[model samples]
Target: MSPRSGLQREVLSLYRRALRMVRTKPPSTRAKFLLFVRYSFHRNATTISPRQVSVIEHLMRQGRKQIEMYEDPSVKDCWVSKEMKEWNERT
Candidate 1:
Protein backbone atom coordinates (compact mmCIF):
# COMPACT_ATOMS: atom_id res chain seq x y z
CA MET A 1 0.00 0.00 0.00
CA SER A 2 1.07 3.58 -0.55
CA PRO A 3 2.25 5.58 2.43
CA ARG A 4 -0.61 7.06 4.38
CA SER A 5 -1.59 10.66 3.74
CA GLY A 6 -1.35 13.25 6.53
CA LEU A 7 -5.01 12.88 7.36
CA GLN A 8 -4.76 9.07 7.40
CA ARG A 9 -1.83 9.20 9.77
CA GLU A 10 -3.71 11.49 12.11
CA VAL A 11 -6.68 9.12 12.11
CA LEU A 12 -4.45 6.18 12.92
CA SER A 13 -2.65 8.11 15.63
CA LEU A 14 -5.96 9.01 17.23
CA TYR A 15 -7.08 5.39 17.03
CA ARG A 16 -3.92 4.18 18.72
CA ARG A 17 -4.33 6.73 21.45
CA ALA A 18 -7.88 5.53 21.98
CA LEU A 19 -6.74 1.92 22.24
CA ARG A 20 -3.98 2.83 24.67
CA MET A 21 -6.48 4.70 26.80
CA VAL A 22 -8.70 1.62 26.72
CA ARG A 23 -5.91 -0.33 28.38
CA THR A 24 -5.98 2.04 31.35
CA LYS A 25 -9.65 1.50 32.03
CA PRO A 26 -10.83 -0.84 34.83
CA PRO A 27 -10.49 -4.49 33.93
CA SER A 28 -14.13 -5.37 34.40
CA THR A 29 -15.16 -2.59 32.07
CA ARG A 30 -12.25 -2.81 29.69
CA ALA A 31 -14.08 -5.00 27.21
CA LYS A 32 -16.85 -2.48 26.97
CA PHE A 33 -14.43 0.28 26.05
CA LEU A 34 -12.68 -1.98 23.57
CA LEU A 35 -15.95 -2.87 21.98
CA PHE A 36 -16.94 0.73 21.78
CA VAL A 37 -13.68 1.75 20.19
CA ARG A 38 -13.61 -1.04 17.66
CA TYR A 39 -17.20 -0.54 16.70
CA SER A 40 -16.82 3.21 16.38
CA PHE A 41 -13.77 3.00 14.15
CA HIS A 42 -15.19 0.31 11.92
CA ARG A 43 -18.61 1.93 11.76
CA ASN A 44 -17.07 4.93 10.05
CA ALA A 45 -14.39 3.08 8.14
CA THR A 46 -16.28 2.79 4.90
CA THR A 47 -18.67 5.69 5.15
CA ILE A 48 -16.24 8.39 4.10
CA SER A 49 -14.36 8.65 0.87
CA PRO A 50 -10.63 9.25 1.00
CA ARG A 51 -10.96 12.27 -1.26
CA GLN A 52 -13.14 14.06 1.25
CA VAL A 53 -10.35 15.84 3.06
CA SER A 54 -12.62 18.40 4.70
CA VAL A 55 -14.97 15.71 5.98
CA ILE A 56 -12.10 13.56 7.17
CA GLU A 57 -10.61 16.53 8.98
CA HIS A 58 -13.90 17.15 10.69
CA LEU A 59 -14.16 13.56 11.83
CA MET A 60 -10.60 13.44 13.11
CA ARG A 61 -11.27 16.50 15.23
CA GLN A 62 -14.40 14.93 16.58
CA GLY A 63 -12.54 11.71 17.34
CA ARG A 64 -9.84 13.55 19.24
CA LYS A 65 -12.42 15.26 21.43
CA GLN A 66 -14.12 11.95 22.17
CA ILE A 67 -10.84 10.29 23.05
CA GLU A 68 -9.99 13.17 25.34
CA MET A 69 -13.28 12.81 27.17
CA TYR A 70 -12.95 9.06 27.61
CA GLU A 71 -9.31 9.20 28.65
CA ASP A 72 -10.20 10.83 31.96
CA PRO A 73 -9.54 8.68 35.02
CA SER A 74 -13.08 9.24 36.20
CA VAL A 75 -14.54 7.78 33.02
CA LYS A 76 -14.37 4.14 34.02
CA ASP A 77 -16.98 2.51 31.85
CA CYS A 78 -18.08 2.80 28.22
CA TRP A 79 -21.51 2.01 26.98
CA VAL A 80 -21.69 -0.42 24.03
CA SER A 81 -24.88 -1.45 22.33
CA LYS A 82 -25.94 -5.04 21.81
CA GLU A 83 -25.63 -4.45 18.06
CA MET A 84 -22.11 -3.26 18.57
CA LYS A 85 -21.29 -6.30 20.67
CA GLU A 86 -22.71 -8.60 18.05
CA TRP A 87 -20.93 -6.85 15.23
CA ASN A 88 -17.63 -7.03 17.08
CA GLU A 89 -18.14 -10.71 17.84
CA ARG A 90 -18.89 -11.54 14.24
CA THR A 91 -15.63 -10.29 12.96
Candidate 2:
Protein backbone atom coordinates (compact mmCIF):
# COMPACT_ATOMS: atom_id res chain seq x y z
CA MET A 1 0.00 0.00 0.00
CA SER A 2 1.11 3.61 -0.49
CA PRO A 3 2.09 5.96 2.29
CA ARG A 4 -0.53 8.25 3.81
CA SER A 5 -0.65 11.92 2.82
CA GLY A 6 0.11 14.73 5.31
CA LEU A 7 -3.58 15.52 5.71
CA GLN A 8 -4.35 11.88 6.35
CA ARG A 9 -1.59 11.75 8.99
CA GLU A 10 -2.98 14.83 10.67
CA VAL A 11 -6.50 13.38 10.70
CA LEU A 12 -5.26 10.12 12.17
CA SER A 13 -3.25 11.94 14.84
CA LEU A 14 -6.28 13.96 15.87
CA TYR A 15 -8.42 10.83 16.06
CA ARG A 16 -5.78 9.06 18.16
CA ARG A 17 -5.57 12.01 20.54
CA ALA A 18 -9.34 12.10 20.88
CA LEU A 19 -9.48 8.40 21.70
CA ARG A 20 -6.63 8.80 24.19
CA MET A 21 -8.56 11.53 25.92
CA VAL A 22 -11.58 9.24 26.13
CA ARG A 23 -9.56 7.06 28.51
CA THR A 24 -9.59 9.89 31.03
CA LYS A 25 -13.38 9.72 31.14
CA PRO A 26 -15.28 7.61 33.64
CA PRO A 27 -15.63 3.95 32.73
CA SER A 28 -19.41 4.11 32.70
CA THR A 29 -19.25 6.79 30.04
CA ARG A 30 -16.27 5.64 27.99
CA ALA A 31 -18.31 3.71 25.46
CA LYS A 32 -20.66 6.60 24.89
CA PHE A 33 -17.72 8.94 24.48
CA LEU A 34 -16.12 6.64 21.95
CA LEU A 35 -19.38 6.40 20.04
CA PHE A 36 -19.66 10.16 20.03
CA VAL A 37 -16.15 10.49 18.60
CA ARG A 38 -16.79 7.88 15.95
CA TYR A 39 -20.09 9.39 15.00
CA SER A 40 -18.53 12.85 14.75
CA PHE A 41 -15.73 11.74 12.45
CA HIS A 42 -18.02 9.64 10.34
CA ARG A 43 -20.52 12.47 10.02
CA ASN A 44 -17.86 14.70 8.53
CA ALA A 45 -16.17 12.07 6.39
CA THR A 46 -18.03 13.08 3.26
CA THR A 47 -18.17 16.77 4.02
CA ILE A 48 -14.44 17.28 3.61
CA SER A 49 -13.82 18.04 -0.03
CA PRO A 50 -10.39 17.01 -1.39
CA ARG A 51 -9.86 20.41 -2.99
CA GLN A 52 -10.43 22.34 0.24
CA VAL A 53 -7.06 22.44 1.97
CA SER A 54 -8.01 25.43 4.06
CA VAL A 55 -11.17 23.75 5.26
CA ILE A 56 -9.22 20.62 6.20
CA GLU A 57 -6.68 22.64 8.19
CA HIS A 58 -9.46 24.53 9.91
CA LEU A 59 -11.09 21.25 10.94
CA MET A 60 -7.76 19.96 12.27
CA ARG A 61 -7.37 23.05 14.43
CA GLN A 62 -10.92 22.64 15.67
CA GLY A 63 -10.27 19.02 16.50
CA ARG A 64 -7.12 19.95 18.41
CA LYS A 65 -9.00 22.55 20.41
CA GLN A 66 -11.73 20.00 21.17
CA ILE A 67 -9.17 17.52 22.46
CA GLU A 68 -7.49 20.16 24.60
CA MET A 69 -10.79 21.26 26.05
CA TYR A 70 -11.78 17.71 26.83
CA GLU A 71 -8.39 17.03 28.46
CA ASP A 72 -8.92 19.71 31.04
CA PRO A 73 -9.96 17.98 34.27
CA SER A 74 -12.32 20.77 35.25
CA VAL A 75 -14.18 20.46 31.98
CA LYS A 76 -14.01 16.68 31.89
CA ASP A 77 -16.60 16.42 34.61
CA CYS A 78 -19.44 17.65 32.41
CA TRP A 79 -17.95 17.08 28.98
CA VAL A 80 -19.55 13.73 28.21
CA SER A 81 -22.89 14.60 29.68
CA LYS A 82 -23.06 17.88 27.81
CA GLU A 83 -21.90 16.36 24.55
CA MET A 84 -24.21 13.40 24.77
CA LYS A 85 -27.05 15.70 25.57
CA GLU A 86 -26.27 17.81 22.55
CA TRP A 87 -25.94 14.75 20.37
CA ASN A 88 -29.28 13.50 21.59
CA GLU A 89 -30.87 16.84 20.92
CA ARG A 90 -29.44 16.95 17.45
CA THR A 91 -30.74 13.54 16.59
Candidate 3:
Protein backbone atom coordinates (compact mmCIF):
# COMPACT_ATOMS: atom_id res chain seq x y z
CA MET A 1 0.00 0.00 0.00
CA SER A 2 1.08 3.57 -0.61
CA PRO A 3 2.14 5.83 2.23
CA ARG A 4 -0.64 7.77 3.92
CA SER A 5 -1.40 11.23 2.63
CA GLY A 6 -1.21 14.42 4.71
CA LEU A 7 -4.95 14.36 5.44
CA GLN A 8 -4.77 10.73 6.50
CA ARG A 9 -1.88 11.49 8.82
CA GLU A 10 -3.79 14.41 10.32
CA VAL A 11 -6.81 12.18 10.96
CA LEU A 12 -4.66 9.59 12.65
CA SER A 13 -2.94 12.25 14.74
CA LEU A 14 -6.32 13.54 15.86
CA TYR A 15 -7.38 10.04 16.85
CA ARG A 16 -4.15 9.49 18.77
CA ARG A 17 -4.55 12.77 20.60
CA ALA A 18 -8.10 11.80 21.54
CA LEU A 19 -7.02 8.42 22.86
CA ARG A 20 -4.23 10.05 24.85
CA MET A 21 -6.65 12.58 26.24
CA VAL A 22 -8.65 9.73 27.80
CA ARG A 23 -5.89 9.33 30.41
CA THR A 24 -6.72 12.73 31.87
CA LYS A 25 -10.19 11.64 33.00
CA PRO A 26 -10.82 10.08 36.39
CA PRO A 27 -9.77 6.46 36.62
CA SER A 28 -13.24 5.28 37.55
CA THR A 29 -14.69 6.78 34.36
CA ARG A 30 -11.81 6.19 32.03
CA ALA A 31 -13.44 3.21 30.37
CA LYS A 32 -16.51 5.21 29.52
CA PHE A 33 -14.44 7.95 27.95
CA LEU A 34 -12.46 5.40 26.01
CA LEU A 35 -15.57 3.74 24.64
CA PHE A 36 -16.91 7.14 23.71
CA VAL A 37 -13.81 8.02 21.73
CA ARG A 38 -13.74 4.69 19.97
CA TYR A 39 -17.40 4.78 19.09
CA SER A 40 -17.32 8.36 17.87
CA PHE A 41 -14.37 7.80 15.57
CA HIS A 42 -15.40 4.44 14.22
CA ARG A 43 -19.09 5.20 13.73
CA ASN A 44 -18.91 6.90 10.34
CA ALA A 45 -15.62 5.54 9.05
CA THR A 46 -17.20 2.79 6.95
CA THR A 47 -19.81 5.09 5.49
CA ILE A 48 -17.50 7.87 4.36
CA SER A 49 -15.61 7.05 1.19
CA PRO A 50 -11.90 7.95 1.23
CA ARG A 51 -12.32 9.84 -2.02
CA GLN A 52 -14.62 12.31 -0.28
CA VAL A 53 -11.90 14.67 0.78
CA SER A 54 -14.24 17.54 1.57
CA VAL A 55 -16.37 15.38 3.83
CA ILE A 56 -13.34 13.91 5.53
CA GLU A 57 -11.85 17.35 6.17
CA HIS A 58 -15.15 18.60 7.57
CA LEU A 59 -15.46 15.61 9.84
CA MET A 60 -11.88 15.98 10.97
CA ARG A 61 -12.52 19.59 11.91
CA GLN A 62 -15.56 18.46 13.87
CA GLY A 63 -13.61 15.69 15.54
CA ARG A 64 -10.85 18.11 16.55
CA LYS A 65 -13.43 20.42 18.09
CA GLN A 66 -14.98 17.54 19.99
CA ILE A 67 -11.58 16.36 21.21
CA GLU A 68 -10.83 19.84 22.45
CA MET A 69 -14.17 19.98 24.27
CA TYR A 70 -13.64 16.64 25.98
CA GLU A 71 -10.01 17.37 26.76
CA ASP A 72 -11.17 19.90 29.33
CA PRO A 73 -10.95 18.86 32.97
CA SER A 74 -14.68 19.36 33.28
CA VAL A 75 -15.33 16.29 31.13
CA LYS A 76 -14.80 13.68 33.79
CA ASP A 77 -17.28 11.03 32.72
CA CYS A 78 -19.22 10.12 29.60
CA TRP A 79 -22.55 8.31 29.58
CA VAL A 80 -22.15 4.78 28.22
CA SER A 81 -24.59 1.87 28.37
CA LYS A 82 -24.21 -1.88 28.67
CA GLU A 83 -25.00 -2.34 24.98
CA MET A 84 -22.40 0.22 24.09
CA LYS A 85 -19.89 -1.58 26.22
CA GLU A 86 -20.71 -4.82 24.44
CA TRP A 87 -20.27 -3.15 21.08
CA ASN A 88 -16.98 -1.64 22.19
CA GLU A 89 -15.71 -5.04 23.23
CA ARG A 90 -16.89 -6.71 20.02
CA THR A 91 -15.11 -4.16 17.90
Candidate 4:
Protein backbone atom coordinates (compact mmCIF):
# COMPACT_ATOMS: atom_id res chain seq x y z
CA MET A 1 0.00 0.00 0.00
CA SER A 2 1.36 3.38 -1.01
CA PRO A 3 1.13 6.49 1.14
CA ARG A 4 -2.00 8.58 0.69
CA SER A 5 -1.63 12.01 -0.89
CA GLY A 6 -2.75 15.24 0.81
CA LEU A 7 -5.79 15.56 -1.39
CA GLN A 8 -6.87 12.03 -0.61
CA ARG A 9 -6.61 12.71 3.11
CA GLU A 10 -8.67 15.90 2.80
CA VAL A 11 -11.42 14.11 0.92
CA LEU A 12 -11.56 11.33 3.46
CA SER A 13 -11.63 13.79 6.35
CA LEU A 14 -14.53 15.65 4.77
CA TYR A 15 -16.46 12.45 4.21
CA ARG A 16 -15.96 11.31 7.80
CA ARG A 17 -16.99 14.67 9.22
CA ALA A 18 -20.09 14.73 7.07
CA LEU A 19 -21.10 11.29 8.29
CA ARG A 20 -20.53 12.30 11.90
CA MET A 21 -22.80 15.28 11.43
CA VAL A 22 -25.39 13.12 9.74
CA ARG A 23 -25.55 11.04 12.90
CA THR A 24 -27.04 14.04 14.64
CA LYS A 25 -29.91 14.28 12.21
CA PRO A 26 -33.30 12.76 12.96
CA PRO A 27 -33.40 8.99 12.48
CA SER A 28 -36.05 9.11 9.73
CA THR A 29 -33.88 11.37 7.54
CA ARG A 30 -30.46 9.92 8.29
CA ALA A 31 -30.51 7.29 5.55
CA LYS A 32 -31.57 9.77 2.87
CA PHE A 33 -28.87 12.20 3.96
CA LEU A 34 -26.21 9.48 3.91
CA LEU A 35 -27.27 8.41 0.43
CA PHE A 36 -27.13 11.97 -0.85
CA VAL A 37 -23.65 12.48 0.59
CA ARG A 38 -22.33 9.26 -0.92
CA TYR A 39 -23.92 9.97 -4.29
CA SER A 40 -22.46 13.48 -4.43
CA PHE A 41 -18.96 12.26 -3.67
CA HIS A 42 -19.11 9.38 -6.15
CA ARG A 43 -20.58 11.55 -8.89
CA ASN A 44 -17.63 13.95 -8.68
CA ALA A 45 -14.94 11.33 -8.16
CA THR A 46 -14.67 10.46 -11.84
CA THR A 47 -14.79 13.97 -13.26
CA ILE A 48 -12.34 15.74 -10.95
CA SER A 49 -9.21 16.85 -12.80
CA PRO A 50 -5.84 16.77 -11.06
CA ARG A 51 -4.75 19.83 -13.00
CA GLN A 52 -7.65 21.86 -11.62
CA VAL A 53 -6.51 22.62 -8.08
CA SER A 54 -8.86 25.60 -7.76
CA VAL A 55 -11.85 23.45 -8.47
CA ILE A 56 -10.91 20.98 -5.79
CA GLU A 57 -10.30 23.73 -3.26
CA HIS A 58 -13.63 25.31 -4.13
CA LEU A 59 -15.43 22.05 -3.61
CA MET A 60 -13.65 21.52 -0.29
CA ARG A 61 -14.68 24.95 0.89
CA GLN A 62 -18.25 24.32 -0.14
CA GLY A 63 -18.29 21.01 1.65
CA ARG A 64 -16.91 22.58 4.82
CA LYS A 65 -19.52 25.34 4.69
CA GLN A 66 -22.30 22.86 4.17
CA ILE A 67 -21.13 20.80 7.13
CA GLU A 68 -20.88 23.89 9.30
CA MET A 69 -24.38 24.95 8.38
CA TYR A 70 -25.80 21.51 8.97
CA GLU A 71 -24.18 21.28 12.38
CA ASP A 72 -25.34 24.71 13.46
CA PRO A 73 -28.17 24.40 15.94
CA SER A 74 -29.87 27.57 14.75
CA VAL A 75 -30.12 26.29 11.21
CA LYS A 76 -31.80 22.91 11.79
CA ASP A 77 -33.35 23.18 15.22
CA CYS A 78 -33.46 25.25 18.37
CA TRP A 79 -30.69 23.04 19.76
CA VAL A 80 -28.19 20.59 18.42
CA SER A 81 -28.73 16.91 19.14
CA LYS A 82 -28.53 16.17 22.82
CA GLU A 83 -25.85 13.51 22.61
CA MET A 84 -23.55 15.52 20.35
CA LYS A 85 -24.18 18.84 22.02
CA GLU A 86 -23.20 17.41 25.38
CA TRP A 87 -20.00 16.13 23.85
CA ASN A 88 -19.33 19.55 22.38
CA GLU A 89 -20.00 21.30 25.66
CA ARG A 90 -17.45 19.11 27.42
CA THR A 91 -14.67 19.95 25.04
Per residue, candidate 3 scores C-alpha lDDT tens digits across 1-46 of 9999999899899999998999999999988888988887777687
Q: After superposition, how far is residue 25 of candidate 2 from its true place, in Å?
A: 0.6
Give lDDT tens digits, candidate 2, residues 1-91: 9998999898999999889988998887777778778767866777778678898888889889977988886654434456655766676
In order of appearance, the predictions have TM-scores of 0.93, 0.77, 0.88, 0.74
Candidate 4, residue 64: the lDDT equals 91
Candidate 4 local lDDT, 1-87, one digit each (tens): 999889879989999998898788877667556665666676577689866888988999998998888787544332334444444
Which stretches in model 4 have alpha-carbon errors above 4 Å? 74-91
The global Cα lDDT (0 to 1) of model 3 is 0.88
How many clashing residue pairs are found in candidate 3? 0
lDDT of 1: 0.90
Candidate number achieving the greatest TM-score relative to the actual structure: 1
- Summarize candidate 1's per-residue lDDT along 1-91 as a digit string, tens digits: 7988787888899999999999999999998998898888888887878888898888888988999999999998878888997898799
Candidate number that wins on TM-score, 3 or 4: 3
**For candidate 1, which ten residues in a row score worst on lDDT?**
43-52
- Candidate 3, residue 45: Cα displacement in angstroms equals 1.5
